[model samples]
Target: MPDTASDTTTGYQVLARRYRSKTFGEVVGQESIAETLERAIDRGRTAHAYLFCGTRGVGKTSMARIFAQALNVTDEQAEEVAVGDAILRGEDMDVVEIDGASNNGVQDARDLIANASIRPARSPFKIYIIDEVHMLSNAAFNALLKTMEEPPSHVKFILCTTEPHKVLPTIQSRCQRFDFRPISVARIAEHLTAVLGSESIEADEAVVLRVARLANGSMRDGLSILERVVAAADGRLDAALLERVLGVPPEDIVKDVASAIGAGDPAATLRAMATLLAEGLAPERALDGIAERFRLLLAARVCGDDPALLGTGSEESAALVEESSAFEAEQLVHMIALCDAAGGRVRVSASPRAILDAAVTRMALSERFARAASLLAGDVTVSSGATSKKKSLKVADSTRPTPPARPASPPVIESAPEAAPE
Candidate 1:
């Protein structure tokens, strides 16, 4: 449910709001938690307080509304989700939503404590949803502790927070806690595909996958990115169009940079860096992309090239495996480190391109050093043992002997020189 109060003034609804989950089944990527809550609802064993914890955009608040709706729905109104919609829109009187960030003072807590004893206005339960509950002051939490511990049978409390660690242990002990996990990229991509189908919008699969990756486990963010893409693209969504929209360097350009580093070509590495900068790709973002590829390659070497685990398409994973063969696992780890260091520096550096170029060049040189050292050491494979500490990989070449000792000519040379002087 969305706030329909201001759409006349704004004239539009964002996709995230328009397609918000209306039912438990519609909430993607949180099946386990949803099932648990639904079971609780069915059993009529609702907890007095629930602490919903997770990262932002993972629907802690939405789940709270769902629980509230399930608890308060009547026989006649079972078909209609108006109560749930009202709670979602923050317009319900009985289901009050308090922004802990704004009303986190002692007075606000006292007011809430006073109201906690009252019965519901319309529904069976009076639900108080506190968003970002960790923002509440110490005194405020203390004030609510008594009510939360022993509230009226008709009252329920739902507290949502991104930072659960900041919440007091005493408060948490009195509530049922559910930790929400981040949505996977594949789940998000499927949702995006369905959304595009609903809108009759044509988008390339690659573009959707890229958007999902960019979303980084947030469905709201993925929808927001899709909204921007839909607004920007008059026709179908394609790789080239998305690249421009996201300011991401082309995949080929990033691959070329990786290839150069793998093949130990410093000039090519710098050229790739220049191309990325010329394409208006941020240095930090470029480094991150490079680092991700290296990470995928390392994973391929260790984890057997599974696309799902790698979070890349089959073709891309194959390409990574092929490119990854150029350097040892140790070299890939070193490359990732260089990328991480350069990424940190580019954030504050005035000349980011220079820093990026240096980083890539350094990665290439590192490959050279690894190759040279391996050759000199008789193709020794450097690997860590059972412990985290590094172990020396020494390969002894018995054929390569120590050089013969020089003849003892020093005594004769000194005597001859003395005779000449005399």
Candidate 2:
């Protein structure tokens, strides 16, 4: 079952906030971390400080809130749903949610230090959840070092940062660190399906999967994209509607381009590129799609139709395995490299279309270059099973034997002619 909170306010709430995980078990894709935190709380071994580190939309802040709720809310207070709700909503006096980006100063740190000494208003623990903690200046970090190292028994700290590397090492050392991983595509897709079902919106599996892939392992991003789709949905969602809303080229067009490149057909490849450009797909995005296709193909070639490795459905995995046979692993690697180089140039190039065209053409003609390389490297083998070596070509009369000692006679005649002239 999907875990969701009801929004009673008249104002609209985005899916991300409305569907935020309220309990540790409701957290998606970070089950191990959630379980560990839950065990610590159950064992009465809650730490004084914790550092949550991960990329955006991967539940760092959400996990912090859930942890705080678990620590401060007891069974006696469980009957009081308002208390748990306040903590989860980050509105409780005990759970203070601070945006470090906005209040990152020595004074802010000092204020936090000063407030830590005070007791909780209602809850057992007074928790400070500082998000984007790496934004604090050096002086601010230095000010908080001692407090973070040794806070009052009633006070707890939860530090969250997208970039953990930027946080001072001394601060990190004092807290128990939990590194959150990016959600998997399968998990994101499943979660999206559940969300759509809850909203009574029906979407094609392909559409849901496409949105999940576009989310790129961020559940929040997946929800945001799905929100846009739901807002624009008419009746039932389909692939055409998805492509139209996202303004991306159709999957068939991308596959056509990849097939042309794999077949070494420059004209067909350019025609496919023209179609993509005519459809208003950005050149950089087109390049990304092509690169992604080749990446899947490479995976298929190496891993042999493993859907897990390809991150595709079984049908798509089979199709990729079939398509991958058109190009060798080495050719796919070279094509991917060409796409990467062109991608870099396309970002800054005034004529991105031209760059894309040239890149596809180079990929289409890659076999010719491979052949030329083989010839240059003297690797040509003959029918007699003899390998050629780099040497000067010579014409020899193999059928006839030549007389010996003619060089000595020629030298003697030349010496006699020189003596006569002297």
TM agreement with the true structure for every prediction:
0.84, 0.88
Q: Please give the CA lDDT of all the candidate structures.
A: 0.84, 0.87
The sequence of per-residue lDDT tens digits that candidate 1 reaches over residues 15-75 is 8877788778888889898999999888988899999999988878878887788777776
- Residue 357 local lDDT, model 1: 83
lDDT by residue (tens digit), candidate 2, 249-364: 68888899999988889999999989988888889889988888898899999899887777777898899999999989998888889889999999999998889988999899
Best by TM-score: 2
Q: Considering only N, C-alpha and C atoms within 3 Å, which residue pairs clash in candidate 1? A: none
lDDT of 1: 0.84
Pairs in clash, predicted candidate 2? none
